[model samples]
Target chain A: MADARDAEIDDLINNLDRDYDFHPGGKDNAGYGRDQADNKQQDLQKLLNLWIAERTCPDILPYDEELISTLTDRLRAQVEFIEMTTTDPEAASQSKLKILLVESELERIKFLIRGYVRARMHKIDKYYLHLSTQDTDTKRKLSDAEQRFVLRRATQLKRFYDQRFLSSFPQALQRLDDNSPILPMVDTPDLNEFVFVRVLQDVPGEVVLSNDDSVDLQKGNIYVLPYKAIRKFLRVGEVELV
Target chain B: MALPLKQIGTFLPSEISFLAENTSVSIVPRQALDVLELIGLNLPAMRPMRRVEVPLWVAIILKKQSRCNIIAPTWLSEDSLKAAYEAEASNMTRFSNKLPWEWIEVGELVLTSAPDDLACPPHIIRNLLRDIREIRQAKVRAGLKSLDPTYMQIDNVGAMELNEIRQFVTMTMNELRVLQNGRAEEEAEEEVEQYPGEDSDLEDTLETTEYSIPRDSSNFDDSLRSRSRSAAPLGERRPTSRAPAYEDDEGDEEEDLEMDESYLHTVKDNSSGQR
Candidate 1:
């Protein structure tokens, strides 16, 4: 069930996968081995891209459920292998060397996952005031776990503030979502913030950056432009932040 | 709470190098090693004297163990470095798109871990890489001098090079935007007053910076009044307190906007993002 925000990107990615030629002429061991290798490499690349995008963008992105679950399962099985296979502290030389390589890779992947989740949590916490009060479309950005986290965070903050000074104030004054005209009380992310975006495809139309500047984002060109100007392009997978 | 948003927004040096470690490099094993399934990448079995592709981190590990001889990527050779350097030196305005995004990091990594495997002497390769970097760095500084709040091209730029300027570029762009938005709203707010002094500076900035890529300079006189109204209202609201100061910056920006257009053009094509 893809939401409006990510549905286009989902379709595009699904189409790309369908168009991909996976494991052609796979009867031979070499070909089959290469196919599996390519799949794992693709997964790693996707994870890396997601990690970097989350870190670079100011707002929280939709949770990557499929990629996360698959990688977590693989991580679990690898951890089990490393744990169970070590009956003797001193194994064969080749096996020892093999285990070393596996552990190094395992740590790197773990680091990436940790960075991704932590970046999301940071955004969720900072923007909980805005996200929790927004419409359902905004709420869809959270995963089940993140949804729970934001709920508890919102409730806890409300209670803490009520006990501190907000309880003494009149009901109308206690509202944190007060649309303070000069400055927004309900801290929302600034979408207009400039970011580094790499064009993934030839963007069909022109983007009017200012009254005077407009650019046609062709495939493979990198441009530094506002995140909001290319938000749709980012969601539809036409571009990615560097 | 998380080292401030600015710090978290960009990558640290170690983090950049860590990402670079995943770059695939070819290596020849000194002894046989079995196939091993790992979480991110699957390792194929290796036989002595047979070449195989592996991540740079993995290559470094085996090289440390005297298990493999790392092969430099073709671009890391003396001829490639010389050619890249020559191209860079010849062009003062733009960067040569020939070098990969992580050229600096990869060059540093191989030089540190397996210099013996490089075709040329490590010192010569290091000097060429250094000269190319200096040239590209000069180009980057020149590009930044022409910084406008709106949009700019950054093709063929390296990951580290971008990061080095990340803090300054982002801050300047964001600040410039606030200034632009604030001035327009101020103009529209006092459309009757038109503050002859302030309005003149804003017009100059808009004419020089935004007009660089969007349209012809001939339309400047006619579009002045309409442009102010359109650029108003939707600029993150500028916090009201900083509005006056942002206006002050507009005066200084008029000089920066007078840059030649050739600095930020036509170089990089294939950008392997953050790789």
Candidate 2:
């Protein structure tokens, strides 16, 4: 019975123009145009409902029913608009408006279908991997499952690496200055020069003045003392120059 | 009026004097001399105007230029120019054919710079002949049929053969170089004759840079050598299928054993020794 009805519908669709027109010549027949338009609308609604039922999962499945509904509603609205505009000659005068509405409705449907297909494919891949993991003991079974996992992971890592290294590194490196010092404290001399000078400490004073009492500085291994006494060294060119 | 001797070197004074003595003429200023020079006549030559008879055709062409009043007779004509061009071309073609073969080869080397562009450079030609003969002997020992007569003919001497193509190119380049060194009028004619058909082929193969054989040509050499090698061994393997079959149940168990037995049989038969 359903097949018979579908055949009938197909026949009507195939000869839609001939059945809907009044005559070959231009003439007005409001009743005939309304009936034909109503029949087309019914056929379109039936087709859209069948497509939605076949493609969309039930509420239990993780699928976007709201997006699907929105797309269907927009498509239904366009069908209604096309029917209304074509039935009345006066309303059909805005050809550009009709075209714009039809185009926008098609674009929306295309975007929704693309999104749905991408999401559905990703879900199917995940489901296949899960099922393959369960049969781990068989030799061929494990290898096939592992190969699938490797391919999926490789695709994911390739995308991540491209985004991280190839796209972002150039701009990040361009923002740095060459002269900016990385460690300023270690490079400054004031902190180290005073500490080196403090290292030369004298023992308890044995009146450590003696001849020409300038402060008697101890000679560390790095420092050397001349053979002349301190006061003689102070006198005008008296000590041997070393 | 004859040009003053002082102005002879500064302009086309000889042509001017001849035009002045021979025809009705006008003197164009130095500024219009450039325009006159472009039209293949020197302006400084025309002076002391008088009427002379030019052909109807020459007068009609000159009348359209708007620069000068048409003299009845003009010295230049389209037919005379075309005849001069053809005469010059014939002289160059005659000269090119008489050039020495060595000089032709040298000229070809300068043009193409490819060893294969000149009769395989004599040494390669000798080697190719020897190799083809050796390959033929091997084919006989292997009981293979002689190569097709057409291929042999092409190999010996044909247009597409390497050596023949080389000789053809050498001859062509020698002709071109001769044409290049000919008189200017001859050179112009030669350019028209040589460029239209031959230049496109030469441009495709003979790049201006030094020629080196493409690295991928090793594959061509490999294919040639392998084909020669395959032709020799094919005869020895033909009688192998005639061996008597022995039904042994154990033979089915080992594939490698069957291969080894057949290989040994082939070796023993070829080596003329008992297995």
lDDT of 1 by residue, B32-107 (tens): 9888888778887899999999999999999998889999999999999999998898888878888998999999
Looking at model 2 chain B, which ten-residue stretch has the lowest summed lDDT? B149-158
Ten-residue stretch with the least lDDT total in model 1 chain B? B261-270
Error of 1 at A66 (Å): 1.0
Q: What are the clashing pairs of model 1? A: A212-B214, B156-B268
Tens digits of per-residue lDDT for model 2, A37-103: 5554344333332222212221112233554555566567666766776888876774533344354
- Candidate 2: Cα lDDT at B202: 21
Model 2 TM-score is 0.15
On the 0 to 100 scale, the lDDT of residue B244 in model 2 is 39
- Pairs that collide in candidate 2 are B16-B45, B53-B72, B53-B73, B54-B72, B54-B73
* Each model's DockQ score: 0.27, 0.00
- lDDT (0-100) at residue A97 of candidate 1? 81
lDDT of 2 by residue, B1-275 (tens): 02222221121322222212222222221112111111111122233243333222222223333333442111122333234334334542211112121222222222232223232243543344334334433433332132211111111111112222332332233223222223233323332221111112322322321132222323335433332222212212322322434223323433234333544555565345221
lDDT of 1 by residue, A153-226 (tens): 89999999899998997664566554322223455776778889899999998998865779999987888898
